[model samples]
Structures are given as C-alpha cells and as structure tokens.
Target: AVALGVKFLDAQRKELPQGGAALADLVTLDMSGLDPRLGTVKIEVACDVQNLLCGPEGASAVYGPQKGANLEDISIMDSALNNFGEVLSRVANTNLLELVGGGAAGGLGAGLVGFLGAELRPGTQMILDITGADEKIKQADLVITGEGRTDFQTAYGKVPVGVAALAQKYSVPVLCISGDVEGSPDFLADLGVATCFSVAEGPTTLEEAFLKADEQLERAAWRILTVWKLAEECQLKKLRHS
Candidate 1:
C-alpha cells in the first residue's frame, strides 16, 4: 500500500485504524496468518535516507516547523513518534528507531519498513526506478530539468541532478532552469549540468517571480533552443570549410 502522509499512526489522539489515546497505545499486535501475497508486493518511498525516526534531529523536529508545528506540537509529536516506533519494533522483531530514512514523511518511512518490508530510498531514485527513466533517457538526445531553485543543494538528490545523472549514463547533456539560481555556472557544470539559467532576467521579488513563472519559462526555453540551433549551424559551417 502506498502511504503518503507522514503520520502513519498517531499516538496522542484517536484516529481510525492508526492511532490511540496515548503513547505506546498498541497493547496488542498480531501479525501471524498474514496473506502471503504481501511478500510479492514491493514498497518504496521517496525521501531523504538520513533522517532518524525520533529525536531533536529526527523527522518531526527538523521538518515540523514548516508544517505549522509549534514548540508544543513538536514535543507532543516527537513523543508520539517514539511510542509508534516502539510498537513497530516489537511487532516487526527489529528496532526501527535508528533506521536511516525512517523519519521521511513524518514517521511513515519507519512504519513502512517495519510493517511491509518496504525500501526507503531517495526521492529521485525512486521516481526513476518507478518511471523507467533510464529507458526514456536513452531515447533522448538531451534532457532539460528544473526546480524552484538551483543551488549547492541541487547536487544532492535534487530533481535536476537526478535527471542529469540518468542522462549522463548515455552521454546526454543536461540544461537546468529554475525560478532562481544561487550557485555559479562552473559549480553546476562540474555536477554534469551543462548550463543553468534563471527564469527571471532581472531583479524581481518572489511574489512577482511566481506570477510570471510560466511566461518566463516558456521564453527562456525558446531562447535556449534558438541558441542551440545557431550553434549547430555554426559547427556544420566550420566542418564544411575544413
């Protein structure tokens, strides 16, 4: 089963089929006589593989702030994740607390691993695996990819880099476009990005940039392809002269 929400099981409150009134809420867990068909199903998730299931640096504490989780919410959620982890560990006959990438999507990563024998992997890799991206890359001469921003982090499993990696396998070049750019072209080129461009041509606020993103991207792509055609013609001319 593909679970999206991070909160696979809540411990603090009563939720349907997933939670209870307190921490360590599961007093009973029976896994015997389960369907054999489950083993045939492969489960995978897209998330960082470095996050712990619980603690200050765990999934909740680090990602909670962005989800409107205040200090109190974080404290409560962290405890809840701890309880949930304990229950999963007992049922699965293995400890999930230290499972790398277990904190992805809240604590769902750990739960899937414990419950379904799922494999937790980077988002990019999972997507490529699922979509048969390598086969598609083989059919293409070039790959263009983008994200909200291009920066140092882009080298680390970001979409552009992920796509670029696959394309690089067949020696296909990659170009990236983004809402904004925070790194130099040289840095990105070394990471296999042939060139990177921003949608915004001049100074613009975040609000304005978003409003014009579609138009800006369209124009940027046209400009890039036009330049590429010109360069191709120039190369052909040089070959003929030689």
Candidate 2:
C-alpha cells in the first residue's frame, strides 16, 4: 500500500516544477481511526502542519472540518491535500498518509510529520518553555492568569493550571480571572491558585456580557491596581513617620 501510494505521488510531482512547495509545506491525509482522547495532541499536530503547509488557512481548510466540517468543503480540501501528499511522497519518498499526526487536522499533521519532518512535542511543555512562564513567576510580585472556563480539563495543561504550577514553584500568589467561576473554589485552592474572581457582576444575556467584557476587564484591573497603590502609599507614609 505504501509503495503504490509512493508511485502515484511521483507521477504527480512532475507537473509542479517547485515540487508542490507552493501547495503546502506539508500534506496531511485524514484517516478515520484517530482517537478522540488525543484531541489536544491532534490539534497541536494540526497547527504544526498548518505552519508547514502554507499557513493556518491551509491547515484550517484541511483539518477544521473534523471539529465541524461540511462534506462538500472537506472533499475539495481532501483532494488538494492528497495531491500535495502524493507530490511529497514522490520527491521525498515519504508516505504521509501512514504517518502519525498525518491525519491530524484531517491528516495535515501527519502530512507535516511525514513530508516536512515536523516533530511532535507536548503542546503544554512547548508553551511553557517558549513563554518563560516559570521565570516570569519567579520574578513577579504576583501572578495572574485565567481562561474562558475552568473544569477538570483545566488541570490537563490549561493556561490557568500552567500559570499556577509556575507560580507555586516560586511561592507567588496566583489569582485567576474567569468569565464564570464554576465548580468548587476549593478545588483550585489546592492547586495554589490563591483566588478566582468571576467577571460577571450579575446575570445578563450572552451578547450583553460579551459587549461589556472589555470594560469589565479594565474595571477589574483598575480596582486591583488602585488597592495596591493605596496600600503602598500608606506603607511609605508609616515608614516616614517612624
């Protein structure tokens, strides 16, 4: 099967002089057997493949449908990816369809790994390393982070958890700001997130809440900063009198 796939690709490569380089940096073929539990891993692979392909748009067209893809669009994108994959196989002797992560983002992840030699790394670890979040926590007076929502999955490398882990290492106070604070607050307390603040003042429609998010965020930040400033001023005044 792999040999036949490779032979088919070689024939297609002759048509494109740049050798499908313009089509995609990588080609992913979506196969059906992917596990759902590996969704995050698959997403990371898809994003990487998108980078290897021309960019996010290429990846989105190829992989976006699995999340919620229409049949007609998926078919068109699939054909494009398959042709690109064939070209890669002919020139590089790499059968992208059989590769892991190849089926990511409709098999784009596999395509990148197979054709572009992209490596798969844990997404959280990559983010932590790149952001220097640990170092930031070590140096900051306080660390604040949050997400759109917090759930059991939050422990599985969500932004809040990642920030809290780093903050814990430094014994820094970590505060979470969320759209809604559901679940037990005590659950997060154990994780070293000192407090979680909900942005909502009262119940309202979804559209109304979204419209006010910017103002609410600013108000919250201002309130926090004002308290910090006032406390600092009082401390300075006391020191001067002493």
Say which candidate scores most in TM-score.
1
lDDT against the true structure, per candidate, is 0.76, 0.58
Q: Which ranges of candidate 1 are over 4 A from the true structure?
A: 1-42, 48-91, 94-100, 129-132, 185-190
**For each candidate, how many residue pairs have backbone atoms clashing (under 3 Å)?**
1, 12
What's the lDDT for residue 43 in model 1? 77
Tens digits of per-residue lDDT for model 1 on 1-242?
A: 22432233334433326432244454434444456677799976777346788898787787788789889878888887788788778878888998887887777788789878888788988888889989988998778888887765566457887788788889999999888888585687776889899889898888998899999999999988898889989999999999
* Candidate 2 error regions (>4 Å): 1-122, 227-242
Instruction: Rate residue 76 of model 2 by lDDT.
Output: 55
- TM for every model, in the order presented, reads 0.63, 0.48
C-alpha RMSD by candidate, in order: 5.7, 11.8
Error of 1 at 48 (Å): 6.5
